[model samples]
Target: MEQNPNKPKILCVKISSNQRFFILGKEDGFSVYSCTPKFSLLFCRKFQKTGISIIDILESSNIFALVGNSKDPNFTTNKVFLWDDLNQKSIMEIAFPTPISALKITTRFLFVLTKKKCFIVEIEKRSILKSFSINSPSDIKPSNSFDFSLVKRDSLHIAIPHKLRAKIFYTNITKPLVELTIKLNTPSYQLIKFNCKLTFLAVVSPSGKQLLLYDLLTGELYQKFRIANKVSKVYSMSFTQDDKIIALLFNNSIVRFCSIQLNETTNRLVKIENQMKNVYKKNLINIEDDTQGICEFNEWNDLLVIYLNGACYRFTFDEIEKKITDTVSFNYLNSKEVLESKFNFNIEKEDERKHKEGEETKTGITSDKLNENKNKKTNENIENELTDLVELLEEQKLEDNMEKEKGIF
Candidate 1:
């Protein structure tokens, strides 16, 4: 993509799965378009841009579907019609059990999590393979709402958090093969949880006051840390590639990096690891006042924080400084003349290097030619000497005095 200095500063905003598409439930007819990564529309509806319109935008995936709920009671059917990117045609509508609470797509399956249950459907066949219900633990009452994250490891694992307990189950099998029930130390059971590589499980308390790390394989608490402020809630948590640094986002504004160390001491039920050491913490960009949305870290390690004022900032983590730096360099060019001069200097240097290489190559060729000439001269001299020797032998063979001397004897 070409970067235009004059181009409007557009911070790519990712719509969460929880939010419905903007085009959905709109009174005024608005056109539906599939927004792709290339910023091109696959299809456009006839509706014009109205001030108030609902567009259901999928997070990360640019595919969007137009959903509308009619005023009539009998017209409550939620039909999800999506534009097929490959075919560039609208596909047949599929009936959803409930208004889709969340939608996730993988290579093999497209998962739609509704308020009632989660449905795993095959993308190619467009058929539901299995349906799983999200429920509370046996001891606890069934929860109406639960947060789940799909885990892809040796087998597909779904981590579901109900009230106080976070349970993990194998999604592929009809019956759950393994189940893990997490019991937190905090009183408020709301856990902001995420699973990393199906091995490392991290959970933050509701207030971001405490963090719990656990090993899913052994069902043991790996480490726990307590933050000072209880007002700051952790929106997201992630581990670096080395697993040494644990990055946490607070209220979608501040980002903190902590060093992770494992303790060797054995504990009774939970294995106590080394305390989480806060290495780096900073608010890369504050968007508390903005109504647009919060910031998130992309897969490219780019930090995208959007402000309510329609201003967006993209930053990358600087390893040396242990801080985030804006991707756009503000002071890229001081003056056009200076930039032109610098470019000309670079061109001149490259041309001079090429000219010097050419001179050296020409010198090498000349030296080779001189050596060849010397060898040719030496060969010519040797040939002349051989010719003289042959002439002398011929003259000696034509000797008439030897026969005359023999006759005198």
Candidate 2:
């Protein structure tokens, strides 16, 4: 029961931050697709059996960072290639001592993470801008666990977990200008992400079963929510460009999308699970292996998920119906028309929409404060108070659902 070696299989997907392009790393090589104005297969590069394990595109450009992986890898695991699609060649290459585990490319720099060290490269100059190392590093391969935020107010922020602690670095240059450190509780964290604003941090607790949110400024835990009560490996987690919503994909048929609300008045980050939506397709995962899917968000809060099994899906939220609808789906392996998808979105109006939503959330939080004054509760009493709150919220949701059903009947 062996699959054909010549058959196409999407190994991973890397989406551009601008929502204009995405790279699909296949068993042969990689292909590029236009994402914003139109969804169409732009071009592809084949490397025989050499497959890309990880890739990061530089803001919808022809240039991208790649790390190869395959039974017969064309490049070594410790090497990274900066390939220029227009030229169809590797414009630059960097060799690391340890196997390159993960990488990300931004407008200014390319961040590469190894098991023992982390290196930052300036894309324009094509030079290693700076390198950082921990006294001791973990041997685990980080997937969507390590991430850095875009430059905001002059500092580029990086988050990497070392010795079970998340070490955050803030700098604008090769030399250290500033640094911030945060430590978590007894449980280990597998995923570490900073919101685009750098105001909040999200991590996976208990091996991706639960999500914990912390304030990056104070390293104070704000909220904790169980993403999956049962055993489900989280495949990926991504925040929208506007930082309004987050998408999480488990190693199953479930892709969960939830709204994120920040109550600045209370300094609380609230994950509205009631607003959560799931896109379920039994074939989303390979089911035979640990091949993980990728999930990302467009500026308009639309979602795109590419599974390793070659299924690509696009989802849109309908505010009028309070629903998430799977607008389009196609398999990249079988369809050359993946680029012909007509789901065009306008990102220019996203800023205004975010402002309006922020105002509405502030209003809602103000009214919620009037209903419950548990802000001053002690940590020792928080467990019971949270239980009561969850029970009350569940009852309210059940009643609302029943009323809706009655109206439909």
Model 1, residue 251: distance off in Å is 2.7
Best by TM-score: 2
lDDT of 1 by residue, 1-409 (tens): 2224562222222333321111222233322211111111122222222111223333323234444344433223344544322212233245776665445443334555555567766544568877766643332211212333443312445555433334433332323666666554554333343433445566665556677776766656778777536455554455554454566656546667765564324211245655655667765443462133333444344444433233344456765577766553111111121101000001112222211112211111112322233333322322242233233333432442244231111
Instruction: State the lDDT of candidate 2 residue by residue for 1-409, as single tens digits.
Output: 1234776566677777656567887666777775544455766667754677788775534456888775443476887877644323454577788888788876556788877678887655657877876422242346554677656313567766654344433333432555556666534565667776667788766466676667766676666665776766776777776665667777666766555667756534654433223332224433444556677777666777766666667787653454676567766566563322111111122223211212211111111432343333333232243234334443543554466421111
Per-candidate Cα lDDT values, in order, are 0.41, 0.59
Error of 1 at 41 (Å): 11
Off by over 4 Å in 2: 1-4, 48-50, 70-74, 134-141, 152-154, 164-177, 264-291, 319-322, 337-409
**Candidate 2 worst ten-residue window by lDDT:** 357-366
Clashes of 1: 10
